[model samples]
Target: MCVQLQAKDLLEQPIWRTAELIKQSKRHVAAPDGYVSSFIDFIELHGGEIVTAASSCRVTSGFTDWRHLGQMGVDFGWGNPVTVLPLSTRRLLGSDEPCFFLPHSSVGEGKGDGGFKVLVLLSEAAMPGFKIEIDKFCSQEFGQL
Candidate 1:
């Protein structure tokens, strides 16, 4: 969304369009274009640990698309989530799936940083860049590796 690339073009993109992309996603190694695991690696390097991770599609009962929750920002509330970015150094999912951290009604009341948690309805395309942004912030603010 930042550079104007459509969602489908980002998420469901065919590997043929970018040959190295397929090569990178293969089992033994990761390509430079890897978005998900890179974020996880960046996070762990910086000491920001993953608190929880799960697939919203499988573990959540959100009952709403959640995007509409963004409207709460008018009253100082975080709206809905649009997607999830998997952050795993392993470059794949096994029994444990991706964790979704999105805008929730109680962001500031939590135990550690005070931000609350909620799962949002989202597409896969939006996650890569999103992961980059959050990981970048963690590195900048907390001196994460």
Candidate 2:
């Protein structure tokens, strides 16, 4: 199921309503004229344009959310992963620097924190400014530095 939503609408609606909208918008994938077929047709029709746009765009970063994938609970003999990081050396979705939204570590100091962690791969040159923004956001949101 694919749901398309405008950013303005998403921001204005409460999370529960947004989730309901997404649920209601789901279409059966088994249909002959499903999203996959439409997507394939679209790609066939605009393949050149897509390639051109991808090549021309300078996408530096990408984001993926893996919060509820139960990665923290998987015991691999050595116990669950203390940290999870993407190992893509090459660009993914044209982004060299990727950010992953991960579940907090389930062991040690992070246990029971009830907060998520974001693993961001950024250039050394960009780190200072990024840290400042992150600190500012944390301070504003949590009333602490």
Top lDDT prediction, candidate number: 2
How does each model score on TM-score? 0.21, 0.55
RMSD of each: 17.7, 5.7
Q: Model 2 clash tally?
A: 0
Clashing pairs in 2: none
lDDT (Cα, tens digit) per residue for candidate 2, span 8-71 = 7878989999778656645545567875687679789986752221344454455567888877
lDDT of each: 0.42, 0.67
Query: How many pairs collide in each candidate, listed in order?
Result: 11, 0
lDDT of 1 by residue, 1-145 (tens): 0022234675777757544543444532354545556656867786454432343334321121233445334443454333323344231221122334544444334423324354433347666877887798877857652
lDDT minimum window of 10 residues, candidate 1: 89-98
